[model samples]
Target: MMTFNARALVPTIAGFRDEVLASRTACTAAFAAALHDTLAAKLDRAVAALHEEAETEMRLAAGKGTEDGDFLYEIYHTCTTFEHLWMESGPISILDEIYEDVVAEGETCRVGLDYTVIPTEQLGEIGGILDRIRRETGIEFIAARV
Candidate 1:
């Protein structure tokens, strides 16, 4: 339930960038865990695989600034581009539904109980979310980037 005060913290570019990263991680994790069980598992696996692949590609990029260092990114991109037409043998994906949320959303959907969500007129939307955040901290935010 810990959260940084956005206006108080995200004033500089680096702060904004870091806030975006944190928000992406937080929002995405919340949104994903709320999806259908099977789809959620699929998403979890895909994100992990993509993250590992991205790290490898980034490492290759870091080895040398030249395009010749390695075609790691290109190779992965090409494989995906041709995935449906041809195939390369690879590991099978299996879903092992583990304990829920790692941080905010713990073992249940209550991870976001203390979140600072903006109110919207969308379906299933809860009211007073932003007010809740404001009242507790004595801070009013007209706009929060995240």
Candidate 2:
């Protein structure tokens, strides 16, 4: 019964990026370091929140005698892609792309909530939020099973 508004984190990420950009000074190295630290902290918090949510969902599914692989798969797919973008592109580019994708894709669940009930729309929002964070923060969230 946990209500996770996936889109809620997008603005947070955007705000974090804006703050870093605003604080950028003539020192390139210092700017980069500050950006990285700020973004990493935000992404870490998001990842932790998502992890807890996923764990709760998995446990709920398990109690119903069902495997949560599908849900996990969805999370893995999104997180892995986010990690890749984080590594490949710098924060801003990746964040922009992720936000665009989310806007374009609308909302769709890549994985089901209870192994059978797929909240596709909400999932898309969730993925989008995470994607933006990953892109902006360059925080590669290491999945437990990926």
RMSD of each: 17.2, 15.5
lDDT by residue (17-46, candidate 1, tens digit) is: 233344344443554223223333333443
Candidate lDDT scores, in order, read: 0.33, 0.42
Q: Using lDDT as the measure, which candidate wins?
A: 2
lDDT of 1: 0.33
Model 2, range 1-146, lDDT digits (tens) per residue? 23333344445655755544444442257534543454456555555554555565555445453356655644554444333444434323212122223233577433212122222243333334435545654443221110
Stretches of model 1 off by over 4 angstroms after superposition: 1-35, 70-73, 80-146
